[model samples]
Target chain A: MVTLKQIRNSVLIALWMMILTFPIMVIKVNTIENIVIWRWMNLLYIGVGTVILSIFWFFLINRRKLEPEERKRSFALKGKIETLKGVLAKPVVQKPLYAALLVIIIIFPFVSSLYQTGIMITALMYVILGLGLNIVVGLGGLLHLGYAAFYAVGAYTYALLHRYLGLSFWVCLPIGALSAMLLGILVGLPVLRLRGDYLAIVTLAFGEIVRILLENLSQYTGGPAGISGIPRPSFFGIKMSLSTAMNYTYFLTFALVLFTIFVVRRLEHSRLGRSWVAMREDEVASEAMGIDITRAKLSSFALGALWAGLAGVFFSAKTTFVNPASFTLWESVIILCVVVLGGIGSIKGVVLGAIVIILLPEYLRAFSQYRMLFFGLILVMMMIFRPGGFIPAKRRVYTFDKAQLEESD
Target chain B: MAAILDASQVTMDFGGLRAVNNADVHIDQGEIVALIGPNGAGKTTFFNVITGVYKPTTGDVRITAPGKETESITGLKPNKITEKGLARTFQNIRLFQNMTVLENVMIGRHCRMKAGIAGAVFRDRKTREEEEQVVADSYAILKKIGLETFVNELAKNLPYGAQRRLEIARAMATEPFLLLLDEPAAGMNPHETRELDEMILKIRATEKISILLIEHDMSLVMSISDRIYVMDYGLLIAEGQPKEVRANPAVIKAYLGEEFNA
Candidate 1:
């Protein structure tokens, strides 16, 4: 029901907007011709557009959004996802669906442009990074702003090893991850006592410190120039074209994303995961519950860093270069956004978050100028209306397969 | 009877103030001990000192797990103390709000379970079996405590009484030889308090776990505690069996006013 008052309010907002833009949008000066013209039609368009938009926003769109129905609906991604999960959770649907999805992804490079596959590989890499950040920020409840420090560590390990010792990507992968894990443990040790705001500050400092070190240590890390001409990972000493290599990286990244999902999912349901959630929930209570919080926290940091490290190596391999410019505070922020834009602690949410945050922007190159504007708008709208991100992570629910009758202790 | 938990001359001085001064508390095998006091009595500080949340400024706490010798738990972290069979709940109900009721209990089994990062990721048969057993054990505890219905519910979503009961269930999951419950019945109604009483008694009978509780509910404390300790102004005013503690002049004076005693 659009009342007269609503229409008046909408018109008043439109008038305010038109007045704000009157100088630039409505008035034109032609000094050379010695003529001044008022673009009354432009003003009319502004008035009509603002009124329509405001009416649509206040009455039509926003009314459905901040209304009383939301709580009953909750922070849900909505009925489509709920219905999708119902349809998808069943083995009859899921198994074949998974197989079909895999087949399509495997054959995607053949059917689609190499550029699309490359973009997908980038997206999948972020999926891995998003899942990694999800562990620290999402599950462990550690706000790690220096997460990319480990990514830098991973990238540097592979790059420097290749540049100096000439180690292969396959050999450098685990070493790169281990180097990050070691750094994670090292980082976790000093920051163990800190919590909340202090922790965020410390981790942020850690990230900057790593970047500065890489920049300043020009002799070792090639300073800002960075190491270039790094080779793509090979499959069993076989030579392949750039196109073939891109597809292979895509396949490899896709497989690893699956592995990360499996490992993280299993971890979430396991004892360590429970303790991590417990620690996240209440540190003092978790301590009283007999969790070695120091060990638990360090484990999460190590695991989260390990994934970031894996992503970093994949990144260095994918780009075939290493530079301080590529790794900045912004890199960490982007990964953080992926986890937050996906529901924190939700695996599928993180995956979707990575895809949306990474892939869509690449395809929308025409509106590339407005990408950050759109990003800011979407984030603001998400934070205001649906703060739980696309898909909120659910707590693990347990059920018994059968009733227990055997009892003698 | 063997004393399962003993804290001697525990004085906690916070800067210029002595929150708890030379307070000694001991709980024996299968005994229900109660610590009662006025609001600023340092009962919680004493509890904290004993549970290793705060190390005492002057004294030491010792716990003897079943089949184990008495060992000093002082200077150890709370997790270490809990591993030694002394588990405590917070007075303010510090449950894992987002975690399910069962997971809340399962966390209690942390010290007992030995799975590492590798075990969690790869999930060998042993790890899987241990996890399943933990789930079963945790559910059994919830069932025993009548929180089975809310087993899958988040800890925050449980009602006031159930939250209190869930605290006890979680503490029990640690398999503590001596369970320290800080105000387990604080917000409970008479009916809920009655159930708590029955639950505590049942826990003692079935699990052979000794209990020490800090409560302001005088009737419940008087009715259930085999022994009682009273504190006032951070001093141990009196300690005895419930009858003796009830009639003690200091206990009465602490509860009533100085004028009433006069």
Candidate 2:
């Protein structure tokens, strides 16, 4: 039986939720009549629903608090979840799962509509950006708040090159990436000594400076009006229409994503990768273990920017336009959220995060006005409940038998 | 015997306070030296100075490798100093908590191995072979340290004693000619301390690496150290063979205290 205090608490929670949801749900606009209307029925529905949900939660929480048996049951549930995770992580299960995912991704464009294909391209672009940022933030333990600046550098590099010099997309790809890398080095050199929040603020300021320069340099960058009529990449001199253009961009991005996965996977197991992990865990100990902090920090910045540059090239080619507004602080925050919400260091997690964050808002278009609010609410809830992400990165393990060591010797 | 590490007249001042003042210390090839003093004696500060964590305000630290010329390594970066064949373990165990035990050791092999971004990303045959070697060598070190059983476990998950051993194993993987240990037995039980003593001896014998440890445990210091240096107020008070250091009045008054002499 629920106590008097439990009932009161549930009621208070219901009242609080009502106050919060009233503005969005109960308030409505009659555009045709040009009048504001208070939808009382909606308020009643929310109040009733909240009261029921709160009472259920109170019972669940109070039972665990009052009974050792309930607490034990919860512990058992957690143990089962851990066991399930272990079982899923085994090679026998993982190999098949990976194969299935590969097959699904390969066939996605063919099965989906043209609009969906466009969305997939956008998601893949964020995936590349997320993976790049993961190296600096997740692996190197650097907080970068202005990562979108590199993306801008990549996009603008392609836009300006094509507009002035008439450079082809294939020719400009590497050049764009190189420019970003150089900028990364330039920015990293001055701020490599700062750690944690200080580094983040500096990077944020750097990002803003890049955007403002792009805006004010109207003669060179086209300023706030942005550059238009940027040409789409052609397939071996084949002129493309709208439908074929969508497919072309999809395949291009797909190939890039696969290459990214391969590079990131190899780097994760390499000597350099291990050094990054060490530096992230403990900088002082890492230095004592002979990791050159300066080299490692600089390399992380350069390499992370490399992928962003590539993605930026694709973003321009896909849209056939470049704008200062496209590369904003919000863009950086979203990409960061994709990295963190998926699983910071996990490639699969980042991919999943990019897809979810990108696609969920698109699907919630029926609630167009409230989509961002809903997205914000979901993100806050995800942070509160699963801070490690939807899929946390797995730790690497090595096992060797005594006989193996002897044989190697 | 050649002096592997020779820090002469080293001084470090933070504002008005002198942390390490006119400190001179040296470790001979294959010798096990101990630096002992009371709390706040600047033993760690001296270790940091030698390891290139801090540039000394005055004086130079010279390292002479076997059959090589003595090189003044003062003001070099810590990693550069480590690459010059001097490595150290922290007084507080600092393992890469999230990484596996083998990975921790593999990181120590970082300076020895040469693989840039291109090699790491592309996985050339040579890079692959080098990585395999690193793994094999790290596993071998773990076996010697008796932590092979926990090789796959996260560094944070290891027992306190094993974490301490892992730190040593990591330092050894750097292929240092001289290993500086900062209070390695700080939180160890008697049994763990004894195991550490034996391990240190084994490392010295097998790896041929000289050891310079700052230890507060008197019994362990007395039993294992070939030579002892006593420090107080950032200055070396006495230096001699263990017996002489034990009997020295200056060391007794400053570190061991009057009761120990009695």
Candidate 3:
């Protein structure tokens, strides 16, 4: 089943995305614009029209071609419908997963309304961060223990730019992301020479250095107290403030979550993704096969940092305040746990892991100071019992094709 | 006959010990040659030196290919050496265990993959077509080596004999003009050894790829090798055709003991 909600969200996001890109577009469209008279407006109009027509054509074609059987097959191949049906069709004893997801979805909206939106917003931000780390640690097998360093760079970037330069939050987001990505490559290059546990140690060291630098650079980074009263994301002429625009923060968070998922999903199926996996499985063999190991490793690091930076920018905007405490090494460890707990390379697993690792501890807050005890125990138990996490990639069975069999005979 | 591979005074020293002391050998085009010796006599070391896994302390290793002049292979990286019409299989069966047998073979054709990152990522029509061709070529190699059925199996899961054959299939995937097989029959049973002999002959005849093999099995070596070099104490003691080398006094001393000869 197609999700109208997702499509509608995509449209909203696409418009906001185009707005963010306006500066570059304006610069590139030199001599062809009257600012607002006919040049830029005509391009936007034509682009939107083309996008709508293409989407319409695709939906119409698929609709026409899909028979009941074909529809079922396509859904079976790509959708969650079959998975949901499979879960529900199981014995009552085995149907806990179906009931559990239902409960969470139902509870999420109600909980967001009742409790502080801060916790929920924070959780959503981590979901994006965890997914980003998953691309490196889970898929690439690089074991990047310093992912939080990139997060710090992003938050610090947005915080400093908005505070000093008076640049809008929207403007700082991409700049922060770019800064984080460049730093990611910088860290990735030196550590690429190391392998496995060594690589982890080097990254861990890198993270500490970044934290120490921020703490020491009082003039630039605001030392320990950190930057405060940072602006929130705005919609048109309206600001996402507490009294009138609280819901806008949640909307912006959700939009980011959706966008992160879209890009990551595309990346997972791409050639670069396959190369990352190949490198992870066997580096010697990967290099022997003509893959430039250095290039693949650097790209993973860059993309992973880019994700953290984007998440950090959103996080600082959402909080309207930033401190060193918010970007601690423990935060990096927590993000790492989410990716591993989710089953490394599995996208759904990472999302589920981020939700559970974050929200589960919050739910057990009644236990108070003992919450840490329960969280640690749950993590240990999960590692021991379901090491593959909630989902694992299936191993395919190889069989000979008929013509080849005939030739062999 | 033109020499496909020429090694002059190849020496490898490990600390104070000379592992390979000034060994010189030449391999003719389309010939099946064997380097035979007792354990730790530096046959494998010589293979390593010639294949660019180890740089010889002092030597020149050159390969003369058709329409191409003799090129120095010494000091080149293994993959770079492979691109220069030379490839090798490992003694311990270094197949990428987690990758499929087909993928392991496809990796050998990695240098041949013309698709760039963009093409590979998007699976563009040209890349897709190229990938299909690679798969076909890999499948064909597998079929020739009696491993077509195991094409999709993980390399680690194959039986001992098939794993050895898979290594050969993988090496062939690189389309090497000169193939090096390091202890190809190291762990094989007698029946498997006989089959490998037939397989190697077939490969030489059909593929037209020269074979430089290191084998411990004397019977297999004597039967299949066009010429054999016998080494003892990191020095070449004998070199000639199977019958000539097998009967040589030094080879007999190296093999059977002086007590047996007396």
Candidate 4:
């Protein structure tokens, strides 16, 4: 049933996709040996993958033909995902299911190995960072390319504080957050009059400055060699085994993730959250609507950076190390990717995005080298194909259906 | 009647170009005023100055808020002006497109509501009650604007005419004493334009909110406006009752030359 037109279109699209994904698949660099391995088998995988994708695309086009012209622009993926979301949306089904999920997460470290728990902690930390950046980039619609700087500030707050002032993890946590918030305000103030690319460049500059400062100031920050032998967060000064410590870090991160989710969700639906989104949508119009544009933007930056700081503190404690290497622009990019790839302005999407971006490459270690390549492709694909993202945020709607109440009666 | 809004000797200059000359416009308590001008007549610039988007080079913008003393809002931030019960819509629709229709209106309630991070996170009784009222009031605004069906829909997904209406509804949500509409009927058809005229009158009649609109649609302007101010090339050419302004030779020669007779 394949027509010449369909076959031609499919081949064109498949080949285009192959070309995009092909270069990354072939070039695998072995960092330890400093040599490149041009893998030919990836060509085979691409060949097969493109064939399957073409078939899928063919059917998608056929189905698309039945829809109206404007509607035909989107793929069948939208409808399929919408139905899936609808099924999972009911409180009756979701309440118990989320509770079960909570229980499983609570007991996960108990059953898993220390290695698994360690990576799990890292992934959860990224989730918190992703949410923090989400407030700035997603909801506030400010492109922040310097998120890692705040994270570094948080890490250093703990690292430098404990070294100089003899502070504990519990004591430095709030201090680290406040310090990052101070930096956020400082950054936010100058960028108040800037928007779009100008703001992006400024934030990028800020991140690089923080990292370079940390690296150059060897006496304070330990330069390229980074500080080690930092103590893991003590559980009430109980001298615990390494495995217990891993489990403890996992639980702490898990708790923070839940708290972040709760707080972010609340903030997203509140007056301040509304103002942030409004500002993002149209600053002039938002100002005319009586939203204090300066306060809203600053609060978003400050609050967004606070989460990153908390995550930063959590990260250093979990790894028992602090360094400039970890807070690179690439780290900021990945966190931005998590927010963008998940769905900007969506709490659930950010969490899922963090896990996918952090955990997927871990599961497929062979493709670890190609992680950034895949991320770039995923971001491009998401922007073009599904701009709403993997699990697009459901519009928060207040139900005033008195009919439903009466129907229950 | 005391003017709700008063802008006197307003002049705006951008570098070497003078966008608005020494102009004076006032909205008295409960009046529908029109600011009509040709393209680049500096109508929007004048609006911008009044809304605090620009600091007039040598003019004063003042508002006499209900139960509050008169305050000069010249060079004040646009948010500050809005806080003083002045809200405006754009010539180009500037809605929160990614957000829901209801949410767009709720943003108008932002300055009116008081809730910070603590209230948002904790949802205390007062915050909870306020949140409920926001929803109720926003929904009511939507219902009044005939956008109840599209309350949950994204603002981007709305029809063009409906999007324009949503902007008005959002402006109304701010509970302003004076609502400014800049080219509200620019892209709308005649039927939509007629509907907008009715809605403008409804707003004035029901809410007791004075309005100032800049428009090219003379029919909509002449029909609804109690008073009219005509501008041409940054100059306020004429001002009087609609008929008086419409008949003025300067305004007729500059703008309404072909259309208005008698």
Candidate 5:
């Protein structure tokens, strides 16, 4: 059943893979002596490996083609798969799945190493930031390229307040968030009228301005050196050690992520949320529908800034350091990437996007210099295959049958 | 009958090119008036001026709400004009294409509903009750327009005629005292136009809402409209009962080579 044409195609694929890997496998740099060396054994191993992999792949693909009953079997298999999916999707099954996930997350830090916990904390911080940006870009359809400016404002607000006024983390949290919200409004007012690329450019400039101001105002902020020795958030007046502080901050960010999810979920289903969707779909028509476009845009900006502010406070407490270099245009771009890579309007997608974007780079550290190249390749692949993100938002569904049943009058 | 909308000396000049020149139009309570003209007669431009889409170069647009004093609404925002009980539909159907039919109507009730961000996030009892009321009211409006069957369908998925009706249903959700419709029967077939005529009459009779429409469908206008105003080159040339306007020489000249048999 293995056709001559199929075998030829597999051989060609094997040849391509061998050619692609030849340079990497056959040549090596002698870092210590600065000399080039040839590795014929490695090249041979790669060529053999590609040949074996292609043979296996072709065998799997050709097996179904060989069996005439495979088509009918697959149709039946698909039906069974759908039934299994329905069962798994039932509320009874889902409730337990959620509970199990919660239990695992609670015990994860205790079981995992300290380094793993640190990585998790970073991922969770991005999750909060991603959710905040999702409100503006995803729901409100406003492209903000300078979201990290608000993040910086929040971090510095807490840093300066604790440094000058001797305020505790608990006291600085609200003030830092409010300050960021105020700045969000101030920056949002004039630029809200501009649409698309123009709005994006103005916001990009605003972010750079904040960074330059922070750097030049070194008498207060420490310039490139940054402020260090910022106090950790104490738990019930007890000072935490390095490991304990990691766990505490992890739990704190976990709770905040849950809160963000809850608030965003509610907003998505509420009147305000609907108005945001309306604005996203058609701005002029939304205004004619009696929605105050100015109010909606401003509120989205403030709310988005509020979350970023909270995340900034947590960032300062965890690192116990702050600097202008820490908040950059790159930071804003990475956070935006997370939101876009996650489905823009979906809460779950944003969370998954944050985890993938934050964790994948760390895991690829073994490749060191090649990790960024690999990351770029993966992102390109994902964009080509799943442009809607890891988890796309669900389309709206209405049950007219139920309404008809109830409308007997 | 008391005038629900009164506009005097309304002129709109877009940098030396006059779109509407000194056009005076009015709608009385519960009256169905048709603004019929050939293409580019400033009928829609005049409507935009009244609905606050554009501020006329020189004009005063006043709305007299039932039992309320008349007030100038010339420079107000479109949302503000909607709040003052005047709502208009676009010539092209402007329903939110991605949203459900029910949601499109519920959005029309936005000005009437009072739930803000805090209320929405907290889910207070009052907000919950108001939200329920909005759903019920929106459903009733859909049913009135015979669109209850497609309540869950996206606006883009509906047929052309249904999309047009959905626009009117959405405008009515604001509970306007006067509805301004720009070419409601533009692409409708004869059967659909007949249904639209009956629906417009029913809206006027049951809701007591005045209708001012810009239409090219002569049969629809002649059959349903109580009065007609003919516009030509930004000027109001004739205004009278439908029969008189149809026979007027100025109206005939304005509609020269256009169909007016209906």
Candidate 6:
């Protein structure tokens, strides 16, 4: 009930209707200009606009938020049931949904022929990273600002392997993943005892350190100039090199997306996932309940790193370039924003956030020079208005009667 | 009576103060023993030291079970102590407020559940079977404690008396041979206290689990505990059956007060 998707669709329809009818307004404006003098119409228009603006502003400012809103009440009941059953059922019902979504995703770019295909691929990558981070951040409740470090490590590993060893992309992928995980564990050891903000700040420092090393090690990483002309992957020796476009890359992206989804889905339903949540919720109690906090946190960090590394492999392959610029703190922040803007532990919400965060800016290209400003303002407004998320994780409700029990007690 | 737990020359100092000093305690099998003391008498401090929250500056606490299972509980973590047939409730109730009553009890069974992450995540046949057994056993404990209905309710949402019972229920779920109850009747009214007295007696008789209770309610303590130990200024002043300890001059002076003796 009152889903964000429905709201988006409705808003799109309203905007379209306004645009379609704009010509009629243009004709009326011309007729009015002819009927009145040009100077007087301009003055009249300004005066009328001021009055309309004032009135609209007054209503908006003075509007009373009704105590018992009908829309909210209608949604609340629906929301409770959905959260209890639908959200809980996600892991259980993933198969059919995954199959349907897989078919749609595989063919989506061909059907739309839109630049949004790129956005989808990017979102899918972020979803993979978020799932990994969910293990570290959401489950373990550890703040990891250096997740991009793992991504960079993965990208570099793939680049080096392909460049020097002439290793196949298939062979290098697992190597990249392992490299990232090893780095994750290395980062984890020093800060395993830290908690909350301290852990975050340390990780943030680690990320910066990695970036600086990549920049300073000019001979190894090619420094600020970066590594270029990385090989494009071929499926059965058929590369998309002749197409002058991104056909093979798209398929590669789709396969990666499927793989990410499968891994994340399995991990979420795993015991490690529960342990992370348990640690996050109550560390002392979790320990008392026989869950090992240290192992849980490390596992979360490593899993998160593994996902980032995998994404980096694809990201480097798609771009055919590795640079310090691509793995900046801002990239980490944007990925974090995508996770946060989607609900942190919520898979669907994160995916939706990634799509919107990426596509909304692209769609605003008609605004030309103001595109970035408009995008920034939209992000601010969305955060202010719906901090829980555009699509918040459904909250579970439980009800049980205890009158007889009280009497007995 | 065979001693299940023996504390020898236990002494704990906190910066400038001696919380528990030169203390000796022996808890025999199949007996309910009460550790009674005045407000500043350090009964809780002794319990904490024994439970390994604070390692005693000098002392050894030994728990000897059947088959010569002897565990020196000193310097071990609270959970470790709990694992060795000793579970404790806090002086100020420390139930996980957000968790359901059933879940809180299930947490006690955490140590018992042999299924690791793989088993739980997959809900494999063994995990499912273990979960079923835990649920069944937890329900039985809840029923025994008369909190079966409030099983799904959040622990914090329960009425005060019920919350106290839930605390006991949670400790029982740990399957401890010796339950350390910190002020079980602390805030209860007369009726609730009476009910608790009967409940403690019933647990003693049926479960055959010895109880070590720290209580301020003298009436309940005198009526239930097979033996009582009174403390003042971190020293054991008196120890015996209720009537003898009640009449002891030192206990009267330290805890009961001169007015009660008069």
Q: lDDT at A161 for candidate 2?
A: 95
Residues A118-189, model 1: lDDT tens digits: 888989999999999898889999998988899999999999999999999999999999999999999899
Scored against the native two-chain complex, candidate 3 gets a DockQ of 0.16
lDDT of 2 by residue, A307-329 (tens): 99999999999999999999899
Task: List runs of model 3 lying over 4 Å from the truth.
Answer: A1-111, A114-121, A168-171, A241-274, A395-409, B260-262
RMSD of 3: 19.9
TM-score of each: 0.93, 0.92, 0.76, 0.89, 0.88, 0.76
lDDT of 4 by residue, B43-65 (tens): 99999999999999998988887
DockQ of model 1 vs. true complex: 0.70
DockQ of each: 0.70, 0.71, 0.16, 0.60, 0.49, 0.19
Poorest lDDT segment (10 consecutive residues) of candidate 6 chain A:
A59-68
lDDT of 2 at A371: 97
Give the count of colliding residue pairs in each prediction.
0, 0, 1, 0, 0, 1
lDDT of 2 at B97: 96
Classified by CAPRI criteria, candidate 2 counts as medium
Task: For candidate 5, report its TM-score.
Answer: 0.88
* Candidate 5 C-alpha lDDT tens digits along A327-383: 899999999989989888889899999999999999999999999999998898678
CA RMSD for every model? Answer: 3.0, 3.6, 19.9, 5.0, 5.1, 8.8
Worst 10 residues of 2 chain B by lDDT: B253-262
What are the lDDT scores of the predictions, listed in order?
0.89, 0.90, 0.80, 0.88, 0.89, 0.75
Comparing only chain B with the true structure, the TM-scores of all models are 0.97, 0.97, 0.96, 0.96, 0.97, 0.95
lDDT of 6 by residue, B1-262 (tens): 4588899999999998998879888888888999998898899999888777788999999998655667688898766777777877778777767566776677677667677545644667877777667766776788899988787787778999998998888788777888889999989999999999999999888987889999999999999998998888888888999999988888878854677434
Scoring the B chain of model 1 against the true B chain gives a TM-score of: 0.97
Q: Report the C-alpha lDDT of model 5 over B51-144, residue by residue, as the tens digit.
A: 8889999989998999899899999999899999998899988888888999999999999999888888899999999987788788889989
